[model samples]
Target: MLDYLKKSFARKKARRQFQEYSHTVSKFILKEEGEIAFANWNNPLVTPKVISQEEVNFFKKFIPKGALCIDIGTNIGDTTVPMALAAGKTGTTIGFDPNPHVYKILEENVKLNRDKTNIAPFPYAITKDEGEFYYHSSEASFGNGGISNEIVSDQGAFQLPQKITGINLEKFLEKNYRALLPKLSFIKVDVEGADKEVIGSIGNLLTKYKPVLVAECFTRATSEERAELYNIVADLDYTLYYFSDFDENAEIIKLEGPKDMNRWKTFNFYAIANAE
Candidate 1:
């Protein structure tokens, strides 16, 4: 164990030798898991270990092999990669994140699996409205956030701003991936506070395909807004499930409706369509 740790640290130190990005990117590889590149490697969202068998299996429950999946707010492809694997090589996993720093790494991670996993990443936010989108991040895309309408922030300090292109995923998919709509099996959304907006925008898809959904109920949002977020899914006839943290063995809690949120403070959850 001691020798393995020493060699592991040595390899990590060696990999950091060529951080060729303004945000200082690093490459980390977990023996069999392949390579993962990230700006803030410590951020749980980009860590390689987060894609354990349990995580992949969790997604496997909702995602069939050769089915289509989507990951919104996919910072640097950690969750995206797992979903891709669960969907198998023939399937496609699409990830969207407007933060360039992390999106670059997201692209790199996708390339690492070019021969094995089918992942297509886009640098557009899944917004409902039509407007100029601006992404501001103090932590260089390591944490949660969205390409919001405003460029300025009252949150204070180091909010590096970048203009981002926005698109409605439902409309975009209807136009581009129209034929693949039947294969749409899952949609994961964790855009900090804009989870509701993304959920609301895909109302048509949710009603038509009724794919399993994973979304977050952010603490920053008002109770009314949170209720509406769940209501959107509930009204679409999907059962809701949540886990407080992304533990490998995390057990999901089922929510009958928005009121169940008061008892379990988990921000993230899975929503499956109800049977006919």
Candidate 2:
């Protein structure tokens, strides 16, 4: 009975917040003057829409204009907008997410940033192979971006289930954009706990393409898994950088300190090519 009450309270709260957000977005649309004013500005899951100006500047500096950037686990495309903005009118930003509910929001977000010349939103997951996989429902949290079947819960807040088609990063890149391979300049991967698999699957692409990578390596990754990740990155001859603090609110920082990024933390790094 207690648990039931708690869930009921949670549902009520979620509905209230969603209503408030709906009002805010409606007002903002009415006040604004643009071609795409009807486009929604809120994330599918209410992950706080707070991004630091400094972080935006960092992305703009690291990601080149006219370069192709692939964002894995793009959730509802919040990051895609800023990335597309950073890439400017000439660049292409591809956002991939398999969750059907979130993919709808991702599509909406792409429309929101329609002024951004070349942004493509794909409803797919970049994994080891082409197959069907289950996606956990996002419970209005940014960390709930994407979850595998093992971590999904039916009775809990996450109740949505999605069967997604996966793609091997290397093979997908070759098949879809073989001629434009050289233009692939940066990649931001954050596929929940499947980071290792995603990184491993794209090993050849990283080594061959040499694109700058900013991956979200949050907790839940084992030390050995982290080591494996490091080795793979090292094999590509790429240098790593770590963010100072990583939390829902903690901004992604580009460290300028003396400590070598490899030794600091298991996660949070900007792996740049040796030549660049």
Model 2 TM: 0.73
Report the lDDT tens digits of candidate 1 across residue range 169-263.
Answer: 98888888888889999999988777877888998898899898988877667768778888888888888987755544777788877777666
lDDT of 2 by residue, 89-194 (tens): 6888888887665567667666664564467888788977688766654354222545454555642345344466787777777888777678888888887757
- The lDDT of model 2 is 0.63
Instruction: Evaluate all candidate structures by whole-model CA lDDT and list the values in order.
Output: 0.73, 0.63
Taking all chains together, the TM-score of candidate 1 against the true structure is 0.80
Q: What's the lDDT for candidate 1?
A: 0.73
Measured with C-alpha atoms, the lDDT of residue 240 in candidate 1 is 90
